[model samples]
Target chain A: MTTPTSRTRLSPQARRAQLLELGARLFATRSVEEISIDVLAEEAGVSRGLLYHYFGSKQDFRLAVIRHAVEHLVEQTAPPAEGEPLERLLTSLGVYVDYVLDNLTLYRSLVRAAAGGTDELRALHDEGRFALTDRIFREDAQGEILTDTPQARLVVRGWSAMAEEMVLTWADDPSVMTRDELLSVLALSLPALVDLT
Target chain B: MTTPTSRTRLSPQARRAQLLELGARLFATRSVEEISIDVLAEEAGVSRGLLYHYFGSKQDFRLAVIRHAVEHLVEQTAPPAEGEPLERLLTSLGVYVDYVLDNLTLYRSLVRAAAGGTDELRALHDEGRFALTDRIFREDAQGEILTDTPQARLVVRGWSAMAEEMVLTWADDPSVMTRDELLSVLALSLPALVDLT
Candidate 1:
């Protein structure tokens, strides 16, 4: 009989990605504290020892999951290359709406982790948000859409916070408003927000 | 010793409020699924039989907790009687900020429940939001701030959603922004949002 190949044959990146995806699904359905390493290992078809071997501990596993979610959000909402700053911002908002609708479970998991009082988890959550805010600030400054200053930083942060809250509400009720309708509202409000006038 | 007063002597409203307050505290720290009638009774320092006698069932108890949180939010954010519509709206936002900050644990619990897929819970969540949105919409309409139609409703929903998300972010990091800062941002943006001209 041919010798069976080892599970380690899979690359580290692929394994990490798989673990994150599984963790998101589980965390979305139940509280983080309620989930156990044994359940995760069983679900993943890996031994409990192997699961711990990869993630080190349950908390580390959660952190990895949060990082994955953040990375996915950043990739989805990256600003477009060629458009008016306003148009680019609207496009980004549209992307966010689509992401939230498609991944409500994962998005809620991310929001829960961020909102809960875990410093490391909170830092991971802010990483993606700050990145998106920085890009918006850069584009607005380049196009003279906003005055460059420390105060402008607050505008970006405020806008980001508003957009996040809007998405959460939308996720709660898709029938309440279409994604484009929501984005249009933001687009109309953004010029005033950035003080384009 | 004198016999304890019968259940008839206790006001139902007061008893219901007591159960809700206890439920909120337990749910905030633990999963809803993890919380049993027995545990809630024990935590409240009441007998399990009395707990059931008050709430009727676990589901009813959960609903009561959600309703209590919603009512508390409404009470805090009631519009100011004598002010410019804009001022009233901003004042309302400030009140909301204060409520969330003061009741951080309970607010977080309500948010988590709303995000979870529970229809009754979500309706309770939206009722509070709609109450705030309706006030803003009426102000906008009376001031000729926004076109009166479904489109405007979408804008109101978006703005309300953004406000909710901002509160969650603020709760996570109180030092990052102040209530005044948030109100100022909204005050500037609302006109652009509500005023079609």
Candidate 2:
């Protein structure tokens, strides 16, 4: 029933990756609710059946793309294993800001998905935040494994939200200050905010 | 031509306010996109024609509800006319927190509408944010009007977003801390974060 001209020449893994990349690109600027599987398949030059064959459903595909983006972020912003605490923190912050600046679409897409009011998206976002906060706390504590108390959890969660908003605001309008100035402000603010609780 | 049983027996202004109140209650938990005009009208026990007659359209009614909510917030949290700068700021923060706690539904509705991604909603949200930030800045300045630089605007906006997220998180799970503890953390954090820039 299928014409040879319409067939994708890539292998299954390559084709799946291709579709996911296309999904990330489109979802970077558009909401998941707005994009349909048919249109996504059409845009990717694949059949809807093929798209479904790789990912069981649209929700499954969205979750896959989210995981892909989160892994990319964690890899890109991974902190140094050994450095001065403050220096390591600053470097990590710089890496974060740089990544956002370099990949505005991907960063925005990730943030929007995190805040898009779904259990899966929210859980994925929290997973990323917990990893980042744990790193920061460990770095600040000089490798001591601190107790993850409710109070500590609350402080880190609050700090994470603040950091996210700061980055989002700076990304939306870098005219407020140079990237360094924005980074410095965030670095100064986070420790003080986290220490309050 | 009209059935007496289906008519609302209130003055036009009263009927309009009734419909708007209904809208606020519904929209607090539901997005405008999810709620239909006919559904809203039916919920208010009025004809769709009467609902349209008062507000012209669904979007118009939504805007009106947003304005009403913003005005209510402004009125509720309007800082005391006389107090020390920090004192006044804390008082305003307390009032704001109390209002949000007292009227979670209305607060959620306003925040959702502001973040609902339409141009109109974004603009309305900006309007409310500017008003709140301006008040905060003026109060912190202690009766002196400071220059509203882009950096200042960015900081206040970032702080506002942080406050919103913290309150939302706390509201969703008060087991983390008491309302007073959460408020104290926010009150302590905002100044430090805003002072960074």
Candidate 3:
């Protein structure tokens, strides 16, 4: 029999996507600081120069992985259009919690990387948070109570951080509180924060 | 002419403290993952083996740095004992904000390291949070309105996260809102969280 072929060339777009998928898997448990470009290239079965050619640099590659994961999350957990503002928020929160719990490792690394004080990662993380905040604000604005102003968005940003902490704390130890209770706590806090702002 | 002395020998305790101080300064701008032991030893003018002798591993060294910083923060921002529960909290909040704003670099690295997902650092971060929560809870409990219980402490824990986000957000960009406004937002949210819990 002929020797088996080891590789098939992929289109540029397909190759980048494939590499990002592998990078995401590695980044799930480890921060970019812990993983070297050489290791990433080896893991993807490409030369280090190929990695550089494709992504420009390790930092650029890390950003791509994060952006890809965030886009995937936003798509999967996009809230339904038809519900009361609170109802939509609760539904979205439930889906978010499920997603977070399902990918605890990746979520942990995302938080770790975001907090690592890198300007690029911090900006990416903030963009993701603001996107969710905007969604919630849009729903809340529809209720005709809180107008979608700069101040309103700022409040939503703070609320988003609280919600994040709620999910993270619960995911860290679900035994401490029921999921329903956790969701309720976050939901109840939102209106008060909105009113305060 | 007598040979000029370049350095002096120090006691073990003083030497360890000196090394930790140097390590903390470096760590303020970089995560432990990014700072190698060799660099640290070289910066301290000590041998790598001496560093190993002082700290079991890089992880151990990181914990010591974090511990020292936390202790220093607690001492400097210790809330006054004589005031209403809410009054004490507000005063402590001001002091806490000053401390954070003053040591922005170290605080950033501390938050970064804590979220870096290491068990030891996470434990240290949690302990620091709990200590602050306990202080707030003691004052709140004095009012006999919210007794210190596991459930009550849980609420404080969640509140602590929000307060942390508030402080971090403020530190990241002071132009977004006045310091008083941020503190007010946090202070107002406290009653609602306590009520819900």
Provide the clashing-pair count of each candidate structure.
2, 0, 0
For this target, which candidate reaches the highest DockQ against the unseen true structure? 2
Q: What TM-score would you give candidate 3 relative to the actual structure?
A: 0.80
Better of 1 and 2 by TM-score: 2
State the C-alpha RMSD over the true interface residues for candidate 2, after superposing those residues: 2.4
RMSD of each: 5.5, 4.2, 4.8
User: Candidate 2, clashing residue pairs?
Assistant: none
Stretches of candidate 2 off by over 4 Å are A1-14, A29-31, A138-149, B1-11, B29-32, B143-148
Write model 1 residue lDDT over B1-197, tens digit each, in one string.
Answer: 11232233558777767667777778777766666788777676667888888888888887887787788788878888877777788788888888888777678767757654366876787788888777776766575445556656655665666567666666776565566776776665666765532
What is the C-alpha lDDT profile of model 2 across A126-181, one tens digit per residue? 78888887877766664332345576667667667767767877887778799888
Against the true structure, whose TM-score is highest? Answer: 2
Error (Å) of candidate 1 at residue B134 is 2.6
Alpha-carbon shift of residue B33 in model 3 (angstroms): 6.1
True contacts kept of 1: 0.21
